[model samples]
Target: MYGYIKGVVKKVYPSHVIVENNGIGYLIISPNPYEYKLDDEAIFYTYLHVREDVFSLYGFKSEKILNLFLKLISVSGIGPKSALGIVAFDDTDRIVQAIELGDVKYLTKFPGVGTKSAQQIILDLKGKLIDDEVEIKLISDAGKDVEAALVSLGYNKADIKRVMKHINVDQSADQALKEALAYLLK
Candidate 1:
């Protein structure tokens, strides 16, 4: 339910930061946790995540990053940890680029993400991100139109989907489709 947290940094650790708002302390996990400083006032765009067994706060340096994290988590098979890993070393542009280019190798470099999980991320989030502040260029003209074309040409959607899952956002739709098709045929 919380949106953002503005407070003084009480303590900074290698993986988490403690922010003091009023008299309470919030332990926030961040991709680059050490980017914050102790005693410095800062604003963290936060997401309060609660499950059956745990409650935690995940913070981001910018609203764009926070929104990206939320979008990543919405994907099926993607959890908060996976989303955090995607955004930890990669930014919004990098993710979009990975999807557009169908770069499974690059995406798999992130912690906890494997070939299947990476494909799932593309299936769920491809062309679904809201373009507000982040400038994500659509590499495809018709948004998965190429995949549809491949399907119409007798290829199975599931196979095409699997192929497209590795593409990055920086590559054009035509490029991704061609690459995905090649991967599938190989």
Candidate 2:
């Protein structure tokens, strides 16, 4: 029944973080727990997975990632751990693109996903996962340059995609790059 948690990260483990809120520490499993540094105050969009033997909370920095994780676990044969593993190691856009494009090979590269599971994911989610707000488009020449610059500076495509939506495509490459760097650094 818990939705999101706002707290300071008390501990960061390889697979999960402990977030302390209202004097209670919550064990929240996450894809990249290291993304949360100790003592960082933040909000985590959460998913509570309940089973006969387990009661667990999975958290993500963004609601988009939380939604993706929910969709993944909805597919037959995919569980919370497998879905977490997929999102943990890959970019969100890349995973959506793979499903939309029916790239079973790309899906299979994730841990716990084999050929059959990949096909099932494509079959179930191919046309359903494209976010209404974020549509992937072909980047302009200037956009490509800006993306490359961001990649070189250690930003991933998922982060680039999130920031690129706010960039002006008509701007000059240098201007666009400058704008992208500013948005990304924020």
Best-matching candidate per TM-score: 2
Worst 10 residues of 1 by lDDT: 130-139
* Model 2 TM: 0.72
Residue ranges of candidate 1 with Cα displaced over 4 Å? 130-186
Cand. 1 Cα-lDDT:
0.78
Model 1: number of clashes? 21
Error of 2 at 178 (Å): 41
lDDT of 1 by residue, 1-186 (tens): 779999999998887899999999999998888888889999999999999999989999899899889988887888998889889896778787776556678888999899998888777776566344433244455436666777788976456555554554246777766776777778
lDDT of 2 at 173: 95
TM-score of each: 0.71, 0.72
lDDT of 2 by residue, 24-129 (tens): 9999999999988899897999999999999999999898899999999999999999999999998898898778657799999999999999999989996578
